[model samples]
Target chain A: DTAVSQTPKYLVTQMGNDKSIKCEQNLGHDTMYWYKQDSKKFLKIMFSYNNKELIINETVPNRFSPKSPDKAHLNLHINSLELGDSAVYFCASSHSTANTGELFFGEGSRLTVL
Target chain B: AQSVTQPDIHITVSEGASLELRCNYSYGATPYLFWYVQSPGQGLQLLLKYFSGDTLVQGIKGFEAEFKRSQSSFNLRKPSVHWSDAAEYFCAVGPFGSGSARQLTFGSGTQLTVLP
Candidate 1:
């Protein structure tokens, strides 16, 4: 069983189109995160949720919104995506909101906005 | 705020040769450090982490990292390299205790190309 799974492993859409990526973790973790990896392979944290509560928002654009319906799921929705939104998005989960735990990451969803 | 820096953008090593990837971090107090690896078209995998004592921490696939508080470095090392080890490595740092941001700041990854 995959610990962390992300839907739509690959997404290709127009610049103005909107898309959503869903993430679920079976690890029974209390914290989940969304990270963006740019073309240069620089990974940046976009959002984090702990037990369905928004814990951290890294000053991402308004177009990017994260919703966590429950503790085991966190979904990202991009509105009016731009060309620069072409990047890989990874969903990860940890035991808690503390910094000492390890993050189990999903395979990742590669998004390409044309 | 915490930040991580991976000085080497790319590294090449021959199979069976030893390898070392350097990682540096900046923070006010003791920081939680981690080393993650990412294969082609894959997500990041935790290699090793430095939380407290035992500066030299071992990880999966015969990998180890030493945390040096004096130099703010947590460098990963492997005795022998395999072609399968060719991938990107990332270093991340986070605040250790409470009353701080609970996010891991990752560095610009270093791509490893193992030669035959």
Candidate 2:
């Protein structure tokens, strides 16, 4: 289907361990982003890539790294996962030139750090 | 500071009743506003967005939102809500222009509970 798809919809791992979530979009958009929804359901942007170039990075820790292999894929790798790192991660994409500013999102990957 | 605020954490409405969810933002300049809905255990779906032009914007799934520059608010409304409308709603703000590289800042979210 033509949509933003992410792998490992649900992940449960022990603290201090590492894990990664991969996202792919077929929307042919130049901009992709990673957002984290906390337990309070507050969504916050972690990283943003436009045309495979990192353009925006919030105050996220260095342990969380985002790699965009191509314009269609953006992967997030978390090292030494902490219990507080557990949250639902979302992948979104949009046309940078679409002034209306609509974003298409993935189903989300729920991470539970035990 | 740039942030979005959703005053009501939870709102309950009877089926077939009208619904309104409040959203407020604090930004230095006029920002691009958007509303997104998330069903239970689902990803966010764009309801509508207002970048420029008309203050009132129509969205999918019978949703609509009005941008009030004076109040710094973008509130979502529905004439009649369906039972399936029970979900979490989020309000977000982006940079002022389409060429800006800033990411979105989302509100905490409001959970809508539709009673039968």
Candidate 3:
């Protein structure tokens, strides 16, 4: 079974359009995270939720919001997407809320804004 | 705050040759270090990690890393290189015991190119 999965493996949208990427993990983990990989292959943590509670929120812009309905699901929504928002978004999960554990990542969703 | 640095942006190795990727980190205390590999069009996969035990850690795909506290570095090495091993490697560091910081800081990443 796929440990972690994300919907819409590829997304191409116009500027100013709003889109959401849904993620689900069956690893039965308590912590889920959203990460952005820019064109330079720089991976940065966007947000993290532990048991549906907001745990980590980086300095991401307000237009980017993360919603965790449950421990197994965490979704990312971006409003009025800008060109800078074009990047690969990854969903990952770990056994605990601690960052010391290894994370299981999904295939990732590639977002392109034009 | 913790940060990771991968000095080599790209490295090319011939098939069957040994490989070593360097990674340095900056943290106040003992940190949790990890090496992750990302193939083309795929997510990151944990290759190995260093917590507290033996400085040398064995991971999948015949990859291993040694934690050198003196240098604040955890470098990944492999005995032999395969074309399939060509991918992007990332080094990450996380606070060891700080409960407040629950995120890992990843390095820019090193792209491995295995030549036939």
Candidate 4:
């Protein structure tokens, strides 16, 4: 069984379209996060949810919104997708009590905005 | 403002050769450091982490890293490299306190290639 999984491994859509990426973790973690990797492979945190509560909101655009239906699921929705939004999005989870930064990540979802 | 830097954008080494990847961080306190490996088209896997105690830490896949507080460096090392080890390696740093951001600041990854 996959510890962390994300749906829509690849997404290609026209500009101004709205799309959502779904994530789920079976690790029973309390903290979930979304990260974006740019063309240059520079990864940055976009959002973080702890037990369905928004904890870390990076300097991400307002068009992007993250929703956590429950502790095991966190979904990202992008409205009016722009060309700049075409990047690999990754979902990760970790236990807050773990002193390590060991995050379980899902195989990234590649988004291509036309 | 915490940040991580991987000076080398790419590294090439012959199979069976020794490898070392350098990582430096800037933080007010002793930040938690980590090394992650990402295969092509796959998510990142944690290689190792350094929090306290011994400066050197061993991890899966025969990877090891030494945390040097004075230099603010945590470098990854492998005695013998294999072709299968070719992948992208990233260095990340985060605050030490609980309930803190725990948001990691990742470095621009270093792509490693194993030469034949």
- State which candidate has the highest DockQ: 4
Per-residue lDDT tens digits of candidate 3, residues B11-115? 999999999999999988778899999999999998998889899999999999999999999999999999999999999988665342356789999999999
Query: Considering every candidate listed, which one attains the maximal TM-score?
Result: 4
Per-residue CA lDDT of candidate 2, range B36-111, in tens?
Answer: 9999888999898887899999999999999999999999999999999999999998885574424578899999
Which pairs of residues collide in candidate 3?
A: none
**DockQ score of the complex predicted as candidate 3:** 0.52
User: Model 2: which residue pairs collide?
Assistant: none
**Proportion of native contacts kept per candidate:** 0.45, 0.55, 0.44, 0.53
lDDT of 1 by residue, A1-114 (tens): 999999999999999999999999998988889999899998888999988999889989999999999999999999999999999999998877454657889999999999
| TM (B chain), model 3 | 0.94
> Lowest-lDDT window of 10 residues in candidate 4 chain B?
B95-104
lDDT of 4 at A53: 96
Mind giving the per-residue lDDT tens digits that candidate 4 earns over A6-105? 9999999999999999999999899999999999999988999999999999999999999999999999999999999999999999987776667889
Best candidate, lDDT-wise?
Answer: 4
Give TM-scores of chain A for all candidates.
0.96, 0.98, 0.96, 0.99
Q: What are the runs in model 1 whose C-alpha is more than 4 Å off?
A: A97-99, B98-101
lDDT of 4 by residue, B1-116 (tens): 99999999999999999999999999988798899999999999999988899999999999999999989999999999999999999999997656443568899999999999
DockQ of 2: 0.59
- How is the predicted docking of candidate 1 categorized under the CAPRI scheme? medium
Candidate with more favorable, higher DockQ: 3 or 4: 4
Candidate 4, TM-score of its B chain: 0.96
Clashing pairs in 4: none
